[model samples]
Target: MDSGEKRLNELGYKQELRREMTLFKTFAISFSTMTLFTGIIPLYGSSLLYAGPASLVWGWVVVSFFTWFVGLAMAEICSSFPTTGSLYFWAAHLASPKWGPFASWCCAWLETIGLIAGMGTQAYAGSQTLQSIILLCTGTNKDGGYFAPKWLFLCMYIGLTIIWAVLNTFALEVIAFIDIISMWWQVAGGLVIIIMLPLVALTTQSASYVFTHFEMSPKATGISSKPYAVILSFLVSQYSLYGYDSAAHLTEETKGADKAGPIAILSSINLGSFFQHSETSYDFSYLYDTSNETAGAFVPAQILYDAFHGRYHNSTGAIILLFVIWGSFFFGGLSVTTSAARVVYALSRDKGIPFSSIWRQLHPKHKVPSNAVWLCAAICIILGLPILKVNVVFTAITSICTIGWVGGYAVPIFARMVMAEQKFNAGPFYLGKASRPICLIAFLWICYTCSVFLLPTFYPISWDNFNYAPVALGVGLGLIMLWWLLDARKWFTGPVRNIDNENGKV
Candidate 1:
């Protein structure tokens, strides 16, 4: 057995996942999960409407800096405990034995829910992108295009979710190969859009406008508070910078994971932030000149259409570019599903969730978590069901996605500071003296962003514009707590040791 497998045995896991992923492919998994196209495009208009180009540019910088602190803290812990359970496992291993189980359980539910909801958010956005593509092809603009009903959009979301689940059930090598391709696709495609937008645009805004502009139209977004609106705009950046934790969740399947896993987590954040900044900096420069109505329908798509149309009087170029973004979403969802399945498998191995036996089972031939893949798909479909009744559900879903992920990330980091200050072990990627400071800052930022997203986005909040993230998260946690009080506390200890490691150490 290799050193990674040896480490797994020491940690009480059986090395069930194939450790075939290389450094590059491991990075690719996280890279794809935070795809710029998947995260930024859906919320571009809302961000613009909130604080204009400055928020997209400067707000991204602020969010990226703090997110890097979070990533660094996570990387340190990930190196010490390179398991598929990731954050929860790290919390359990690092916390005091008396409180370890409870800490682990809390992180597990938060991270697992965040991951599955991450997939739901991506697939839902992909469905809308597909709808935009069809309308563009049929000679329809946002004003006269074929608008899909809520039910139809939900159907589209379901179709995309199923496709991602099916793809994830393939062989391990196939998934790794697809992830490498996805990384390149996002990098290359993003650069193309950044460079091509200026080349084809009828006119572009100056750097001052792109970097210094700020606006908060009370009439447009129903908020008059500039600071609050700017904070709300940070969602675009926070959402785009997430999903890098997929690296930690996939470490069991990664070679040299003690080092590579941490690198993947850190590098994905750096690279994703760079690309988002560059692309949005350019897209917004041109977007302000485009019609407001067109930009409102879908900012990125309409920007591409207007750019190419102004130069060539045809949207063929825009349509082709849209396909590139759609491809990014397709690959991003697949990677997310892969990561979610691994989380499910790890959680079930310890009886953390209902139906542990089934979810923990892997396919005989492919050795993939086929059951878990479908379970994630099913849950995502259920989450998307609310989209059928109201369009504002999209706002709520995105809010929950941000809150779930940010809160999940903060728990383990906070635990490391308060519970494992001296007890925590360092691995290949230790931060040494810098670890505590980084963890403290990360935790603080997470607390701020979580609370900010819960506040109402619209000023005069009615049922239509209500931000339901707080409600959804409250109910989900309440149910989990209810289960704990009734039954889980009796038996659910965190990170069950599957292997007989009499001489092994964690």
Candidate 2:
């Protein structure tokens, strides 16, 4: 079966995504607000409005520190063996043949699920933004998707997915350029609010709310009594540091991937995390209410709008600004769309995805993965249904979104563990004198984050089905493992055999 993989290497030349993406452009377009990943939509930046700004803010700081350690370790691994398939490639090389296939399979599972969960979470939030903008237009207090008809919200969520699918499927450069445009809007939008909102009546929120330490209600209820309230705050810290590795996953397509790729990933994490620090700091918290209404499971632009327009209910100017904020939110979503295709192409090349045949096909003229791009776009549209039920099981099982991803970080560490015990010289970024100790510490932290992330928001666990977020994550992984043992083992041996270094192909 790998014979075909070999054949793909010598196949005709084709063009799709340009190979010219510079390190700066890649980082700039892909990096997003901390709120975008943690606060708005799915996680609701729980710290900002729920865990109290102080706790949430500090938690993020701790998270960022932890993030640096993890990124540094990954940077070491990535510099040594960069590949578009990301962890799977690393895992395969690090492990022996007997375990290598299993390791690589798990890595692919993690990458796929992480992408699906992350995208679904974001799309759900995007849909809510769409509804919120409409409510703003109608001047109604009805609020977002939770209040809107399920089908309608679903339509919006899926609709945005289609928009992304189509946009991402075709133009990788267009995605990067538009993302660049949106990054400015995101920065400027924040600046606009901080600067402009003050001009009109000092933009009222509550200083006390900003500093308060509160507990989450549902989670406080016996034996499963772990303090998840900590997570509500700390997760902002966790998420702020997440997703920086996405660029490294695309390293094979990047120029000077060996040196620049890992650097880009780390830089994106640092830049994004710093912005979050700025958002959560007391200087900014003073402008926010510690107990500001849970912006629900989906609604960043709405949060932004209410922050700016709520005080000016009667002022047409503030209302107009609210509209502008919504426009920018969509602009932000558009940028996310741009990168979706590349993930497809890269994943396909690794043979980690279904429809591997077509997805591996590059565009005849564009130098991009045409079929892979469309496939991801189509899935985005279909999976968009989850956003409509923002708090439902469909949307709720993502506790493993981070758990699943831990392998990406964990694999290299574990492999380093395996290798160090046996002694093997690795790359420039390889763990040096402190290799074993550093890998051990990073692995422990990854486990800690995974445990809490998997634990349900509710604590004092009653037998009321005991929220299956973690269980679901495990089941998903289990299924992948089962599949690997029974099916993926023999012929699907990752994309390594398909490498076309001689032809400069991934």
Candidate 3:
């Protein structure tokens, strides 16, 4: 019979197998899709202050700078150690085992939970966007409702989750194929929209009217949305840039795994930033707002139809964008599942979880963790149901995801810095001479974002502000801390210490 340590080694080997991602395929899949889905212009800044389109536009510019810093920090870290374990691996190897196990657990907890929640929002956003396009195409109107019915949304969410679960169950190569094809479609669709929207607007309306006469349509915050313009604008921009962190999450799967992953992430954001600035500055904000709405309401569909592709009613453009973005989102969402499952699987190898047997299952056929995919999907579906309650459900979930995931950023960077100071391995991609400056800037960016991350989601803060997003985030992290103290420390310790590779682990 195998001893305890031998069994742990066996499980750890399986986790490594999952990390063997195809580099070229990884880049093609990530670049094409993340760029399209995340390039969503409407949600990025318009969701901002409602204070004015200009403010949201500026906020995006400002956020892009800070976002670049965060990306740079992540790039350096991923390059140093491009393991599938992500930050969890960094935590385990870089710190002493006793503390390292718990620290890495925190990273995994944030990643697993955050990705699940983030995916839920992605599903929600993609669905609503599609819903908007459909309504616009058909010119359908249901008086006074901001969204589709609860039942319909729930059913659709479940359907998509199942589809995602099935796709993820196959294996990496299959998933990569789907993502690559969709990524190209996504890139073409996004550029077309970016170019077409402005040209169409200019030909239809005077440039002055398109840029100057655009109006604000802020969702009610029960306070004057005007005075706190910057805060509101920041919130709006936050919506657009919220999940680009997924690029870092995919680091383990990329070729030159460590370096390319972070570079791709930062690069994608840079492209996204450029597009947002160009598109927002020139495109008619009014076309994005009331009366001349773009993708949100049916009127925009009519305007687009009247403007760009009337005969097809812009359906080809709209549907193509939707399909590309949805496909992007699905791949990103699937990455979340795979990452989450691995976290669970990794923690299990270290004896950090319950039901380790199921979540840790690997497919003999596909060589992927089929169990982790479905398990994470099942959890996401359960979590997604809360959206029926109020608008806050989505915000709160997203906010919590951000805090957890970004916290993933902050903790690992700090831990890596301290380890380097103590003379750790420094791995294949280590910065060496570059470590101090990179680590310091990383430390600074992480601290700054974590602070900015505290501002109320609804903005225009007050006693009645009652924003629960920050609350949800705090509770989520606290629970993770609590879990570590309660259990993780007992069995797991630093990447199955004294790993003997000569004979192969399993």
Candidate 4:
């Protein structure tokens, strides 16, 4: 057996997943899932609406700094407990025996549901990007543009979900190879936009405007407080930076996972943050420089159309660039589906999911979690169907993406901090003396962001403008606790070991 398989045996799991992914492929999964193009493009105009250019630029710097601490802490824990179950598995092993089961259960459900929600959100955003492309190709937003109805968007979302699920059901090697391609697509495509924008734009914003502009009027963001608006704007950066933990979730299929998994998590953040910071600056600057007719539309696609039209008087350039952005969402959703399926399979392997036997099963030939892939697809589709009419519900559902993911991540880091005296094994990527301090900062940042996410984004809140994130989170947490009290508490004792723990034998 290889060293990875031997490590699995020590963790009491027989090696089942094919460890074909090398370090680059492993990093690709995390980087593609955290696609900066998908994250920044859709939210760029809206983020500028919050606190102008300063929030988009400086908020990223601030959030990225703290997010590095978060990634560092997660990487340290992942280095020690390199498992597909990831956050929850680390929680069970790191926490006290008395609290292990409950802690793991919460983390598992949070992480699992969070990932499904993220997949749905990414696909949904891709569908929206598709609609925006259609609008731009036909005409400008103010002219005879085609505005897709809600039903059309939902259909596109379902179609994308099916495509992602089918792709994820392929063998690990196939998906890992695609992930590498996706990494390049995001990197090269992003570079094209970053370089091409300032070149072709009819005008450009001054440096002072790009860095120092601040707008927090009651008319601008529905709030008058600069501090609150700035805090609310951090969501754009925080949301984009997350889902990097996909590396840890795929460790079972990764060679030299104990080292590769931790490295992927941190590298994804470092690389993604660098590109996003640069791109966000350019995107915001371009938006400001566009004509008032386009900038007032408050949509990135509209800005692109206006920019290209000013120089070339054609929409084809804008159309092609919009497709580039759409590709980011496409590849991003695929990687998220891969990560979500792994989470479901790992939880089911321990009998944590409702239908553990079915979800835990890998394809006989491909060795992929085929059933779990479909399970995620079905859940995301169901979650998405509401967008046909009650569109606000989609916003509410996507809100869980950030809170649930970071909440799951924080649990284990918090557990490790509280249980510092426990017998812990450091992996090759150990942090040495800075571990606890990093964990503390990471945990606190998670807490602060979670709280901020729950607050209302718009003032004078009503049914339409209310931030229902807290409601969605509360209901989900309540159901998990209720299920634990009623059913899972009886038999669910954290992760199940298929192999003997002491002797590493079946």
Using Cα atoms with residue i matched to residue i, what is each candidate's TM-score against the true structure?
0.94, 0.79, 0.80, 0.94
* Model 1 lDDT per residue over 424-457, tens place: 7678888888888889999999998888878887
Model 1 regions lying over 4 Å from their true place: 38-45, 142-144, 276-295, 420-422, 503-506
- As a TM-score, model 4 comes out at 0.94
Measured by TM-score, how close is model 3 to the native structure? 0.80
The candidate 3 region of ten consecutive residues with least summed lDDT is: 1-10
Candidate 4, position 448, lDDT:
93
Error of 1 at 416 (Å): 1.3
Q: For each candidate, what is the lDDT?
A: 0.81, 0.56, 0.57, 0.81
User: What lDDT is obtained when candidate 2 is compared to the true structure?
Assistant: 0.56
lDDT of 2 by residue, 290-370 (tens): 233323333343344444455555435544554455545455445444444555566676676777778888767666666
Better candidate number, 2 or 3, judged by TM-score: 3
Off by over 4 Å in 2: 1-17, 33-50, 142-147, 193-226, 277-311, 315-344, 386-390, 393-400, 421-431, 459-468, 499-506
